[model samples]
Target: MNTKLKHLVRKIRKNSTAAENILWKELRNKRQGSTFRKQHSFPSYVVAFYCYEKRIIVEIDDQIRTPRSLYNHAREKQLTREGFIILRFTNVEICRDLESVMKKIREKL
Candidate 1:
């Protein structure tokens, strides 16, 4: 990764959302079979969580700005085309239905 992206990743990691922290607690320590990296930075973009063995990226979709929706849609399409499986969870979804989220992730794995 480039120096700028690396720095951005560090900043993001340090300033995680409450939902991210809650999910991280469950996803850490290889509890789901393989280790997951939080705030992982790739050449294309930075992901909230990633598991290399499962080729899955988990994103907390709390923000709902319309201006970025088109861009996010394109990014999602490109990531899928490149063979990456993405799991998106809203803040409410994670906070209220964590078990269901974990179940879905386990199924993906």
Candidate 2:
């Protein structure tokens, strides 16, 4: 792993939020033959979850006020340009129905 990625992994391990912890529990140990790193950063961006081998980035959003749709669009565009396939899900969605989310992730992989 890169030095920056190491730092990011440390940060994630130390301070994962509830949603991150839940998802990590399900995705850890390369359960699908693909390893994932949390709080992975790339340039000016920090993704909630990243699977480098699969070129997949998953972001868990809990937007209560500001509409994140527009910003998400731009972010996805930027990531797409860099050859990343982005996936977004709401906190509620992930917490309430993690199986569905995991299924979606498996499909993407």
Candidate 3:
């Protein structure tokens, strides 16, 4: 990993959003025996959370202006090709209905 990328990841981990913090609480302690890394940096892009055991990437999508960005599509395609599952959740949805998000993650796991 590049020094710059590692720095950014550390910065993000320190300055996490409310939703990310809340979700981290649930994902911590190897929730369901699944260890999750927050602010994880992949070779292609930085992910909100990563589970190496299941090869899953969890992304909190807060920007609704574009719905989904070209960058995200490209990133998703690349991750898919790499055989990793990508899970995306809106910030509002996560804040309002976290149990549902957790349920989805459990199903994926």
Top of the candidates by TM-score: 3
What lDDT score is found at residue 79 in candidate 1?
A: 83
lDDT for each candidate structure: 0.86, 0.82, 0.87
Residue 106, model 1: lDDT of 93
Q: How many backbone clashes does candidate 2 have?
A: 0
User: Model 1 reaches what TM-score against the true structure?
Assistant: 0.91
- What ranges in model 3 sit over 4 Å off? 64-66
Q: Residue pairs in steric clash, candidate 2?
A: none
What 10-residue stretch in candidate 2 is worst by lDDT?
63-72
lDDT of 2 by residue, 1-109 (tens): 6777777768766976677789988778898679998787777667888999989998887754233678677888999998999888877878999999999999999
| Candidate 1 residue pairs in backbone clash | none
Ranking by lDDT: 3, 1, 2
Tens-place lDDT per residue, model 1, 1-109, is 8999988998999888889999999899999988899988778788889999888988888764232377668877888898999998888889999999999999999
Please estimate how well model 3 matches the true structure, expressed as its whole-model Cα lDDT. 0.87
lDDT of 2: 0.82
Candidate ranking (TM-score, best to worst)? 3, 1, 2
